[model samples]
Target: MPKAVLALGANQGDPARQLALAGAAIAAHPDIEVLAESSVIVTPPWGKTDQAEFHNAALLIETGLSPLDLLDFCLATEAGIGRVRLEKWGPRVIDIDLIAYDRLEMESERLTLPHPYAHQRDFVLTPLREIAPDIADWLVNRIGTSSA
Candidate 1:
């Protein structure tokens, strides 16, 4: 089973509760097993700074699903929790991002592995550091090696 690193956040409608519910739903998915979860951390908005602060956390999961399948699962979880994509980086009820999928690196119209901007966001890094510090190093290495 591949281990996937995921980031979860919410800035609207009881942020902590939203994260909790998202975590539970993700764990209950047949293809995913929650191996570890980080403590939620409070952080300010990212791209859109006008919104309320967000509660963020990271999850390490063991899964049988492929990367795209996992992305679908994350999207489903978001939609199930009433996520609305009204604006870029706008406040949301919930947000689940696939930060990494094992060591796979690829990008398409649908998704990007290792999440393109994860390294640039403290909100994503702090909780992720708690669960998988090595990922930070991996990301650094990837960044160093990438020509783009």
Candidate 2:
């Protein structure tokens, strides 16, 4: 099974509730077994800061599902929670993003893993480091080892 991390967020209509509900839904999926979860954190909107504050959490999952299939599941889960894709980084009922999948890098029109901004965004790195401290350390440790 491939281990994957998903970043969940919501900012409209009971943001926290929406996030929790989506987490449950993702866990219930047949191929997805949620291994760990992070506490919800409230963050000022990132790209679109004008929108409502976001409630964010990260999920660690073990799954047999492929990347595209996992993305489909995420999309379906978002829609199930009344998520509206109105604007990029805008208000949403629930937003589920496949942040990483066992160090896999995938880029396509629909999704990107190890999300493009994963390294740059504190909101993402903080929770990831908290949940997978070893992986976090390995990443940072690699920076200088390349020249060693």
Best by TM-score: 1
lDDT of 1 by residue, 1-148 (tens): 9999999999999998899999999999998999889999998898889889999999999999999999998999999999989998898999999999999989899998878888778887788788888986687668546735
RMSD values for the candidates in order, in angstroms, are 1.3, 3.4
Residue 32, candidate 2: alpha-carbon lDDT: 91
TM-score of each: 0.95, 0.88
lDDT of 2 by residue, 1-148 (tens): 9998888988889988898899899888889999888888888889888877888888888999999899999999999899879889888999888877887766799877656665555666667677876545543444224322
How does model 2 score by TM-score?
0.88
Looking at candidate 1, what is the lDDT of residue 28? 93
Error of 2 at 2 (Å): 0.4
Please, what is the whole-model Cα lDDT of each candidate in the order they appear?
0.89, 0.80
Among all windows of 10 consecutive residues in model 1, the one with the lowest summed lDDT is 139-148
Best by lDDT: 1
Once model 1 is optimally superposed onto the true structure by TM-score, how far is the C-alpha of residue 44 displaced, in angstroms?
Answer: 0.8
Clashes of 2: 0
